[model samples]
Target: MNSTLTVSWRSVQLLRILVSGIFLVAGLNHLIEIEKTVSRIEAAQFKGFAAIFGNLELLVILSGIAMLIAGFSFMIGFKTRWAAIVLLAILIPISITIQVGQITTLGPLFKNIAIAGGLLFFILNDIKTIKKQKL
Candidate 1:
């Protein structure tokens, strides 16, 4: 392999690790504090339909699982396009409905936004790969 190609691969690998680590930690943390997270969700005065989701923890768990799976796929560059799409589908709503309104207490909503952006990048990058795989 050319030196430039090796460097590019290394860069992608590092990005994958960073993205995957963030999702894994966030998911594991949610699972660990499922009750607390649910309570917080209940307290939020959301103006969207998500507030009607009574079993908030279930949603959180499902989203977390999606993130975990997507993150892993991203790290390995395996079916990354689909994984990124699923990850975005799960994350975008939470960011728009939940995190955006709580920025004062949440300090910053950039993390989720950054994740969403990263996932999009991965999806675009994997487009050719996905097509090659007939996915």
Candidate 2:
């Protein structure tokens, strides 16, 4: 058993924690400014199915809460795959409605896409780990 290998593994875990920390901060910010966030979502003109839930603001609020839950779960490494999936689900609509189009929004659009890619990478890595364990 190489001590260096053990150190490298620990370093990887630390990086994962750091990555999850970003989501934790984002989630907390959404929760702290929930009313403002919901207002912004409404301002974004999110219509259609979102309206079916009675009030769009409530749906937006719920989505923000979901993000917070997913972020917390990811930070704690609890059902990380499911957490990533939930985050991905939340990101898709946001990327489509808020981040897409407009030259001014392009940067955030790409950033969200990159974040989704990171989540996908985590998911694939988990699948690989499960497969290895079964073999």
Candidate 3:
């Protein structure tokens, strides 16, 4: 590849790492605050399953694991696009439900949108590569 292309690739990989690292840190912290986290979820009026959400210690653990794997893939630029898409899929809805309408805080809402945009960048760029591979 040309030098310009190589630099562009490296920049994309760095962006992916930065985005995924945020998810990894947040997910790991969730483990330490499962009860409080669940309470917050409950407070958000997530609906129809308050008790189930309160007991989501296991799910919190799994989410942390997913974030770590996704973060590593992003950092290494291996399946980077797939990992970003997965991260966005898992985060966006939860962000909207918990942070957007409920919180109404500028920081949280904008952060979510920014992360979503980052994942979209990865996905769209990679889709072009994927299409080439398919031909």
Task: Show where candidate 1 strays beyond 4 Å.
Answer: 1-7, 52-54, 105-107, 127-135
Between candidates 2 and 3, the one scoring higher on lDDT is: 3
**Residue 26: error of model 3 in Å?**
1.2
Q: Report lDDT (Cα) of residue 120, candidate 3.
A: 88
Q: How well is each residue in 26-102 modelled by candidate 1, as lDDT tens digits?
A: 67777778887677666655635465654677887877777777768866878877877877777777667667778
TM-scores across all candidates?
0.74, 0.70, 0.73
TM-score winner among the candidates? 1
Best by lDDT: 1
Clashes of 2: 0
Cα shift from native, residue 26, model 1 (Å): 1.5
Which model is ahead, 1 or 2, in terms of TM-score? 1
Clashing pairs in 1: none
Q: What are the runs in model 3 whose C-alpha is more than 4 Å off?
A: 1-7, 47-55, 127-135
Give the 10-residue window scoring lowest on summed lDDT in candidate 2: 126-135
lDDT of model 3 at position 126: 45
